[model samples]
Target: MTTTLTTPTTTGPSRARRVAALARGETRLLLRNRTAVVNSVLLPLLLVAAVPAMDLGGDVPLGPQLLSTAVGVTLVFLTYYNLVSTYVARREDLVLQRMRTGELTAPEVLLGTAVPSLLISLGQVVVVAVGVAVLGEWSAPVEYLLPLVAVLLGTAVMTVLAAASTLFTRTPESAQITTLPLMVATTSLSGLLYPISSFPDWLSTVARLLPVTPVIELLQLGLAGRTWDGEVVDAGGAWAAAPLPLAVLAGWLVIGGVAARGFRWAPRR
Candidate 1:
């Protein structure tokens, strides 16, 4: 039998398309991980439910604190914590190393790996906002646009932190320990559960300096516009807190970038 063979096209899938495919694969893997799925969805909700017990100050109210808690907890568990384990798992499995040897660039691989987590984090943020809105009325209108800046910037910071932390993570199982410092420190002192305004002058000042503080601050500034009487309040207005936190976020981003330069794609020897 005689047959004619056709040559394949010189152009394959576009770069964006390839990256998208990678993200899809990453998302599927995340879905298959039962623990990851549960933590990403349920953990944030559980954490936020405790806002009633948190002292976000008398003026801040449980509703506003709940909203802030939802955003902060979701971002931490869904994006930052998840990425640490995922990156370590990929490194241990040799997936990252294999990708480096193929057509996918390092940046593409990192971005692709982040896609699933980022999407879930954003979804959690939405759920938090909706639940807060549906529960009752905000004393002041939600500054939807301003807090979005915090979410976007905070996510970038967390992504970098995850990448950096994975360098020390020996295995997927060790991810919990490697990730604990950040989770514990930030949750306790970063105002993730409580408001900075609820703090004494000394504590609020110090809290603002923590790596995670700016994120929680920005989220609260945007989502929780309640007034506080006995606690620390910044001069000027709610917007006054914006610039300093933004600058702090930028500084952390730089540090994360510097740390990433030493990232080891291959397993540690």
Candidate 2:
């Protein structure tokens, strides 16, 4: 008679515990990067300080514009660009791949990686609110839900886009270069740093095509209380009336999701 021996598999930490642990570790690493903290957290606050000086007599109030721009930079720096570098580093170091082979589901892995960034992003939002209130009168947005929606949607979109961006990013070092194009486009053209309403119709039309424009516009609507009466100013501000509100943002999220499906999870051999 022949007997067969079987080995039982052991489970890892509970889902909540696993995610929390990953987030704690990731947060530590994230904080250890002093340059990241300074650039992502401090620089945006500095920009907020400068926003007041750049008002230059606009229809949009300086307070709302400054607050919106400040918050927008936080989202980009903490959520979007930060994730690109984080994901690339993790993937290169095989952290992501190892997690994939464990008890962590793909969603869990993604959530774990994003936990630190999201927390930092949320904290910065509060800081912006309080700082703006302290510096100037803080009137809540007329469309309150829109700003929250903008933050939620923007965070999700940027997270997915960051993952997708890793497909072409060979190493963590090259992330800055690959990320620069989108960063510049979104910060400059998506109405994050300035109002697209102030732009020419032709320029606004082009800016609206950018993935981040809808989120930025929603942010302006939410944080800056900016709403156009579908009235186009010059030839460049057509983006003000574009069909890129929630619909456009959702579309970009889908695009990012699709793009991430093709990502290489392991470092190239």
Candidate 3:
């Protein structure tokens, strides 16, 4: 009998599938880390709760300010700090190095590792938004798209910045120290805890350029439909208010990406 030649076809998981699988695994690991879980889950809500207690002393509406604080804190501590620790831990364990030799590409590996944190941050922000609407008696956002765009781009910016942070973090424990500068800058200068409007004009201008400031600004504008200077804007006006912050975020994405290019996947010498 003549034998016919046969070819085999191989199929692999899609990029989304791959990332999801990695994210699931990461979630399991993250759950085991009590500190990470507490920080990611509890700290942000607590901080947001504390926001109303602060003598915020401003004309800005409390509801939108609370929402912005929740999102900014989540992005900072949950996504950015947690990802920095995860990246360093994975690199130290050679997990990143081994993954690099597999079918997963560099960007895939980074994004996959970051997926859990990103998802958690987004979910928490949604929860906070609902809480703001219900318990805080907040109205629906006039410019929903601005806050949505802010959160999406803000996540991307934080992810890249997290990857960049790992370049300085030698170990997971060291992430606390290495993460501080951005943390300080974001919390203090980004107007998350204070109004940039209260700053001197030049300082206010500079604060607007910080990485997380635009995201907070966008959220404020979207939720309150009011600019920093107390100008009321309709939905269409929100689009006009977006270009500067969007450009600033885009610029930071570039800066963070360039820095992350030098990230070490292997254990440090």
Candidate 4:
């Protein structure tokens, strides 16, 4: 006679317990690593402090501009760059593969691993927001709430992007090279170093299509309580008015979801 055997299903606390244990383990690993800690925290702090000294002045208030810039930088470095590096490192270490055999689902494993990074990012944002509000004299307009939404959406997109990027990264150390293209391109084009309005027409058109552009536009609009009304054109000279930054942000979320669907917890052959 042939016999069938099935694995037992995990119960509520079993799932929660697995997530909690993973969170603790990941947190300890992150905190113990000096380079990771500095990259995650110190770098963002320096950028936030340095932006005000550059004297990029205009009709836009310093408060909103600094706040927007600070938050944007934080989102990129903390959520995007840090998460990608960490995920690659863990996968190379077989941490991700081991976790998959536990009670956690793929989504749960990803989220659980990400919890520590997310908490650190959120803490940094809060601290920077307070500092900007006090020293930079930043008071966000009521409409600025919309940009906060964009900031959040941007973080989610960044997380998924990190996951997808891992497929190309074979080792933790190689992540720096793999991540550079997106990081440099997004940082330059996303209005981190310069305002998008100042870009040449052709460059601006291309920049608008990059994921970071919409997030930055949303931040600028939220801080200033305005929207982008400029023309966006493709190479063929087919032009359309820029959609509301909010709409652009929502679209990115959809794209991130699609990208995330293909992310693998185990290495692909």
lDDT of 2 by residue, 15-56 (tens): 678889899999899889898677667765776566556763
Candidate 3 whole-model C-alpha lDDT, 0 to 1: 0.81
TM-score to native of every candidate shown: 0.83, 0.84, 0.90, 0.82
Q: Model 4 over residues 1-269: C-alpha lDDT tens digits? A: 11111333678778787778889988998889888777667754775676558565334566666666666776677777778888877777777778667666776677778888888877776766777765756764635355667778778778878877776877777888988998888888877677777789889777777777777666656566533433332322211222555566677677776666666565545
The Cα local distance difference test for each model comes to: 0.72, 0.71, 0.81, 0.68
Misplaced by over 4 Å in model 1 are 1-13, 44-58, 138-142, 197-202, 226-236
Model 4 clashes, total count: 0
Best by lDDT: 3
Q: In order, how many clashes per candidate?
A: 0, 8, 0, 0
- On TM-score, the candidate that comes out on top is 3
Off by over 4 Å in 3: 1-13, 44-55
The digit string of per-residue lDDT tens for model 3 on 113-198 reads 99888888887887777666656648788887899899999999999899888877889999999999989889898877677878
| Better candidate by lDDT, 2 or 4 | 2
Clash pairs detected, candidate 4: none
Query: In model 2, which runs have C-alpha deviations exceeding 4 angstroms?
Result: 1-14, 56-58, 228-243
| Poorest stretch of ten by lDDT in candidate 3 | 1-10
Query: After aligning candidate 4 to the native by TM-score, how far in Å is the CA of 203 from where it should be?
Result: 1.8
